[model samples]
Target: MYENMDKEYVLNTYPRNYVNFKQGKNATLFDDKGKDYIDFTSGIGVSSVGHGNARLADALSDQVHNLIHTSNLFLIEPQAKLAKKIAELSGFDVGTFFANSGAEANEGAIKLARMYGEKKFKNKRYKVITLEHSFHGRTITTVKATGQDSFHKSDFSPYPDGFSYNKDINDIYNSIDDETVAVMIELVQGEGGVEPFEKEEVQKLAAFLKSKEILLIVDEVQTGVFRSGEFLATNLYGIEPDIITLAKGLGGGVPIGAVLTIHKDIFEVGDHGSTFGGNFLSTRAGCEVLDILEGYKNSGELDESFIYFESKLQEIAKAYPALFEKVVGLGLMRGLRCFENVDLSTLINRAFDQGVLILKAGRNTLRLLPPLTISKEEIDEGFKRLDNAFKVLS
Candidate 1:
């Protein structure tokens, strides 16, 4: 069976739960044994338009049958179109650098910040300030950029320097020295207990940093691409970041990442590149995703979907305050912060056993990043399963 083969051949990197999905329909996934489960993860918010999407499948299939990869050596059609589409949707009149994952996008953004500092500051000002509990990625330098200590294990000791984690603006300012060049953040800290930064605080911090000429980098890797009811989560704070890193949901299940530089051109030829970054297939998939999202937006379906997602979570939290005392996050990216005595693992497992797939964040936050294309009926079914799980626990 694939399970045994996966256990034997695949690297034991992930927790690798007992569930093995065979296929998916909208927000529902079916196990190999034919049991159905309502998916609330969206593969950690990657499948923005839902799985088995006809438009996405058709686009990918056409791209597969035609052209897949041509590297960056020559011009690619979908890549160019996707870049322009991002510009149209985001209103960022700047260049975009393509990469393959969130880590790669963050890495590129870091390089851009450092490059900017190197060229403009006349002095060495390459240090980037990040917030505590922020999750960037798994790459070595990104691990260093991540604010969590747990990700900085002994195995990857002596992490690459030039990054600092701070909780408040005073702490960030205090930490800034002659080497500080930029401050990176996520408007909605998805992994950090689904915490949404207040717009006023974000505006204040952004203004302060701008006064110092320090660039602002928003890691929209998890919060971008209409996941938070906007083209980009950075728009929610009304701040135009010097650099925005996007991935996860951009490709709608395809592996693709991007670094969008807003009105700032720091990279020249031979500055940065990725081998499999902006391949034809990935860009084509991205185009289809945008098409689907734009369709949803135009038809008023997207707004309706987000309203349902948020209202259901709020209702559920109110219904089961013992298990989930509060709800946090914007749009579909949500979390239920548990009470002190609630065991997160038990609750997650209970939900999984009740034919529902879910995720967690921070210590006790039940994170939910369901597909944006999820229907109201699917939402009802998922909440029904969640109610069953909460009933067993509370």
Candidate 2:
């Protein structure tokens, strides 16, 4: 029916890769035609706990029964509780400003850095250094902050001047003479392809920037909330970033974002605001998701699962060296780097045909963001579909 309806509907937008999806549970999705598929992409890293988690559904439903929303004008209990929990998890004894999406979180982080620069440093530095092959968001300022030149096409010029991109550590050092305020980086550059920066390089840059007293902003939209085997990927680097941006999996399946700062002194009141951010419903969702993840951490079950899952991926990469070049990334956020001249979109379509949903990153990388609750059986099934896809492509 959807295929038929599309015939009459305008195709102004680019064609979608998938034709249909009827329903889903955990790490499986069913199409309108009744084919079942293992879901490896996890809605591009949004469904962290998995599809239709009963706990999340029950929490959301229970909240709807009592209170769905109250304006930010009035103090909300759920929002406060969630904020305290997030602050505790972030290792920051500071306040949080919430938003509805990752872009808003990034925007808020950018604003906070600029304010920190203005108030603390007397506005000596206002430029932000974002790394090349990074993806921020589609908003005007974020698109400009994004380092990919391809994204600059189609009237993205007149961009905010403070944002610039750099390639090497020295290049970044050169970019920050006196005008640079903050250096924002993604531990794992998700949309730019699943490229994890070298640890030594990152540590060197962080040390230099910290000596300069510049704010280090880590974009954890895709790496935070235990998706990378830690609450925040920064914990792995052992570096203390000044500001961090979070979204995607914070609220389980709900829309929520947060801008966290290590020092609360950077902002006075009236520095920023959000209408629907940290309201009753969204904050409740975030609190519940965090609670669930914390339970996993205590049980050590998640750690075991991820260790096994990542090992399996490495084994698969070794088996198919011709097609699967290397498995990049940590924990559940993995990228299967394919050989050159191979089209991952076509390969993903073939996987879908064989009953598995996946996503692509960069040009030749097949990104996999399976739900945290996915079982070993499901992982094996998804890889079977991937193997089939490789066969078809070959």
Candidate 3:
């Protein structure tokens, strides 16, 4: 019914998995037919606190009863509180602008950088330098910001100006010019097969940008919010970016995006706004996610969980060298680089049939973005299913 209904009504944007999930509990999902699957995708990293989290549910429910949205024209308590919490956790004296998705957050960040360049340089610098294989967002401007050509190949032509891509530091240096306003990058290129940037290179780039009075924008939509063993990937790498865009796992299972900046005075009245951003329900959910993460941190459980998942991934890579080339990424955000002959889509489908839901990152990398709240038992079970899938594929 869903397959036919989706074909009739929904636009064919995604080649979705065959199963239609009916319910979820923690890292487990139950399809409409009552078939259970270990969910490693976490709805592409949105359900960080895991599915059916009572705390998030209660917070969202209470906000729904009280007030869901009051527009940006009016002051909202949850929005303010959530912003403050994010600022504190970000470990920077920052200001935040809320949006509805990662793309919107990045769009806001781009606008902020342009405004900052205009206000400070008075030279109308607008060009932003991004890395090759980076994925920022899907908006016209963001599609241009995204360095991959595949994302912009179709009818979205006459691509937006002021965006350039670089493969390395030399490419970045060459791309920078008098009109360059900022350099935006994803610390871990999640969609680009969970590729991680070298630490020294990132630090050097940040320093170079600072020396030139250029802003550094880190797209942490997929790497932030405790997905990388730290609250922010910047924290993990010790890179102090001027602006950071966050979404994906920010509101646990709810949709919320944010642009955080250390440059507190980047925006003025009427400079930027989002009508549905930071609504009561979304902010409440964001606050609850932060609370859960804080608890994990304080109890030393976050580190433990990260170690457990990392070790398990390493074991899998070592145990199955013929299938997995290597395992890359930090914390629960990992990727299994498959052998050249391996068909990732086929493996994913096989895994799905074997009661395990996973995702592909690039062409040959099996991306694993399990909930930070995933347990040891769930990890063991998920790996067992994956092993079974591998055997079947073999």
Candidate 4:
């Protein structure tokens, strides 16, 4: 079916880069004409357990029958279960706030950081320092928080003033004066092309923030939910972040996000709240996703998967050194850097035509965020498609 109807009906801001998706299952999607493509994008890091998982379907169906949205004014069972499970699984001091998306969770974290500063420092600290090239979300405040200045707009004018960015550890340290409330970072910068911070640099900066009594907030919105082999990417570094934000896979195919704080005293009723943050439906999906993670954790399947996946990716990277600058990332959330002057748009389109979906980040980096439940057969098929895409590029 022709999609020109979309041009008449929808807003033109999105750039509609591809055809409309008809249906998806596991790691594949079909278009209107029944053309199928391997979904390496994984809904940009959502869909952890894969598309059309029977368990997630059942959970959502059951919740649809029981309850959907109740005002946060009353207790909800699925929300409580999810909260408890996240706290237990995350090893935090046991505080969780739910939200509908990554940006909302990030907004919650920003508010919590400011509130913590107000309560502990008597309102002396309020600034948050982020790094250059970091991508948080699209909300006004998060857009301001994003390190890329291109996200700022004229009408969005007078962007939030407290957030700042620095290029190096020394600058980041020197920039943090008495008013700095928090330092937020992604251990592996995802949208910035899977740029992993140096362990030594992160350690030094973390130590400085701790010394200044500033909160360390890790934005794991793209790196969390076991996408990087660990439950949270921050765990790999052994740094104790005061606040951690999560989305993108927390509820499998469903939308959900959360902020987990180390201490519970920072937020008071009315200090922060969301109307549809912890709806029964999303919470039920979250609980089922947690159950899936729990099973994978106990059975040692995730460990094996990570081991096999990493080795395979590395092998492919080595084979095509001339075409790629490097392959960098943890586990399934990986990036491929093309040699300078390579047109990534052309390559991505070629991959799509050849039945593989890929994403671009930064300037010359191609990103792959496949579902955790993707099979070896899917990987082989996707790789072959990517190889064909590269052939066109070459």
* Pairs in clash, predicted candidate 2: none
What's the CA error at residue 359 for candidate 1, in Å?
A: 0.2
Question: Per-residue lDDT tens digits of candidate 2, residues 1-394?
Answer: 6666776685746556545777878898887878888998888898888888899999999999999888888988988898899878867676788899999999999998888778777556788999888998878888888889888876756778789899745688877867788999999999977888877888888898889899899999999999888888888777778888999989987999998887788777788888888888999999999999889877997898798888878877887777777889887889889888677878788888788888888847989898888888898888887787667555
Off by over 4 Å in 2: 2-14
**Per-residue alpha-carbon lDDT of model 1 for 135-176, expressed as tens digits?**
999999999999998899988788888888998554776787
lDDT of 4 at 236: 75
The TM-scores of all predictions, comma-separated, are: 0.98, 0.95, 0.98, 0.95
Model 1 spans with C-alpha error above 4 angstroms: none
The digit string of per-residue lDDT tens for model 4 on 1-394 reads 3457777787788856658788888888888889988998898999888888888999899889989998799998999999998877777666899998999989999999988888888656889999888888899999988888778888888888899998755688788877889998989889887888887888887887888789888999988888877788877777778899999899997888899988788898899888899889988999998898778767877777667767766766777777788888877888888888887888789999999999988857889898887877777888888887776555
- Regions of model 3 farther than 4 Å from truth: none
Ranking by lDDT: 3, 1, 2, 4
lDDT (Cα) of model 1: 0.90
Candidate 1 TM-score to native: 0.98
